[model samples]
Target: MCAHITDSVLYRHLWGTDETHALLDDGPRVQRWLDILAALAAAQAEVGLMPDDAARAIADHADVALLDLDDVAAETRACGHSTLGLIRCLRRVLPEPAREWVYYGATVQDLTDTWTALVLRDVGALVARELADIEQAARTLAQQHRDTVMPGRTHGQPGLPITFGFKAAVWAAELGRHRARLTEGRRRWEVAQLGGALGTMEFWGDAALPLLDAFARRVGLAAPDVPWLTARDGVAEFVNLLALITATLGKIGQEVYALQRPEIGELAEPVTTGQVGSITMPHKRNPELSEHLVTLARLVRSDASVAVEAMVVEHERDGRAWKTEWAIVPEVCLYSHTALRLAHTLLDGLRADPDRMRANVDAHGGYLVSEPVMRALAARIGKHAAHEVIYEASLAGRERGVDLRTALLADSRVTAHLKADDIDRCLDPEAALGAARSFVDRVAGEA
Candidate 1:
């Protein structure tokens, strides 16, 4: 009966986690709204804007289990307002005296935006934890494969030699940067939004600032300099950070997908017992998780664009922009959560083939060591001139189906400056890996 794939009974596991789904579900969302109202009431009472007894009563009955959500929905539709139905339903459950002061002067934005801050705090924490785990796994790979030589590629072709550890070190370094971003961004995106209808808090008079601080304290968030009723930069920034994170994950996935090809056969995603890659093809091991990571990144990036668009709303209050976040925020969180989880699983059990990697490098007929050859020749015959000589020899070698050493030996320009022993040294893949092992050590040591 679900409409979206994210909510599908059979496939929801692919899109989100149970913990995040529970956090954003209707029951928990409403409970959070009620909790925000209770915090507001308590803060209002603390500021002497409302009676202590009424605040206590509202707090006691703030449970979502006590309300008839059907009635709440009908009232919402009847009133054509986002929070009125919920307010009315809440009033019905409250004692007579507390009913009048249940919501007070707060608007829907106050409740929803604060709820968003809380959600971001939770999601950001989850992301940070998952990123740490992923970083550690990548670091482990880097250490394990510090000397596992592979062909470094550029423009989809073998360019030079590199260690698999170097590649994993890159992933770890990027993930570490994301972790730092999360830590720094928490202060900006995890603050409360309690501006009333006009964002001026005029309804509460002199007690506004005090109430804001108290409410934020109750919810364990920082109070902002002002209400963000129309300023959505914080939300946009957080979503965009998620976009950056997923994009990195997608990059890693793409690498795995490419290397898992039978022709390359240097890396692979871990396959579980009895896992079927295809129903039609009996001999196939598709890079399913890697492909899904790319798909999730695309979706998260799309959501980030919507978040950016939401930043340009009209003055004071804009339902068009604000309501978009109602959908976009949860979706970005869910998709990002799923991505982090999958990435962790992927890296934890990732399979690397050292022999296959060495074989692939050898398969290139010493072409992968061209960079080292060019560099060594550069020191002798001026860099540009050596480039032309190597370029011509490389083309001839490929046409003649011979190794780089044979090609170089036949080229008078190359043999004139370098002997066979020098050419052999240049063609060594280990010599071609300039500073790769050192970089791996640096990244893994820091990790």
Candidate 2:
């Protein structure tokens, strides 16, 4: 019966976690809707808008398990009303007094919007916790590899020398910024929405604002100054943050996947027994988790674009814009949670070959450290003049298939002030990692 890949039992674990699914699944969502209705009744009574006994009756009998969901869906189809079906179904199960007060004066947006707020609130906390764990893992990696030398690449080519700690520190700092955003964003995203029919509380008379405040308090949310029936910016802001978080995760995965290549052999993702990388390649081990992080990030970003599109509305109520969230919200939630979970696992068990990284840095003879030789010669000769000499020598080295050290030794202009020993001293990979260790210390120290 499942149509979307997210709903498939076999594929669901790849896309979402059980903790997130419990919050977004249909049964759980309906139960939350019922809980919202009960809160509404209790608030109405607190503000003297409804009888206390009526509120109690509605609360006691509004259990989703007690109501017949089949009739609810059938009535939804028959009436073409978004919430009337649920209300009608609840009335069938409730006694007379509670039956009339089930939904009270609220509209569909009122119920759905508040539920959205509640979902964001819960998911926000989950995201914060997971992000903190990811940051910690990055910090650990950075500290452990503070002096682990590696070739820093640019444009897919090894350009210079850098410590592996520097790379992990960059990820840790970015994650820290995301954590700050999530902390500040909760206030804006967790506020309640209780605007009745076009956002004007004409039905509730003088008890309108009080009932709204009471309802928000009952549900552990802040009451917005005005109903956000059409203002979709809060939801947009929240999902946008999720997109940014996933993008950061994707960046980390990209590095891990690239460095895990057999040619590079600098980094390796953890592999356990019984895990198959490729069916045909018997000896191959693939970066499956790292690659999947990238895939998850792409899908979440696509969902984020649609979520932002939902910001444009016609008036006080635009099902066109708000209802798009019915698809976007859950997808972003599931994708983001699953991405964070995988990233944490990858980082925790990640393997790094310090010896391999050192070997790769030394693979190109002295070409990778040409900048050091260029800089040392620049001080003796002029800057641009030394660059031209080194550039020509580098070309000759490439054309003749000899290393930069041999080519530089042959040039009497480079040998006039420096010897082969000086070239060897400048070509040391550990010497080229200037300020890398200090930066790693700064980031890990702050941790």
Candidate 2 overall lDDT versus native: 0.91
Put down candidate 1 lDDT per residue, 215-266, tens digits, no spaces.
9999989999988898899999999999999999999999998899998889
TM-score of each: 0.98, 0.97
Q: After superposition, how far is residue 138 of candidate 2 from its true place, in Å?
A: 0.8
All models: lDDT? 0.93, 0.91
Model 2 C-alpha lDDT per residue in residues 1-447, reported as the tens digit of each score: 699888898899999999899999988999999999999999999999888998998889868889777888899999998999999888888888777887888999889999999999999999999999999999999999999988899999988888888999999999999999999988898998898988988899999989889999998899998889889999999999999999999999999999999988899988888888778998888898899999999999999999899999996788999999989999999999999999999998988899998888888877888888989999999889889989999889889999888999988889997888899998888888878999999988885
Worst 10 residues of 1 by lDDT: 367-376
In terms of lDDT, model 1 sits at: 0.93
**How far in Å is the alpha carbon of 276 misplaced in model 1?**
1.9
Number of the top candidate by TM-score?
A: 1
Q: With candidate 1 superimposed using the best TM-score fit, by how many Å does residue 6's alpha carbon deviate from the native?
A: 1.2
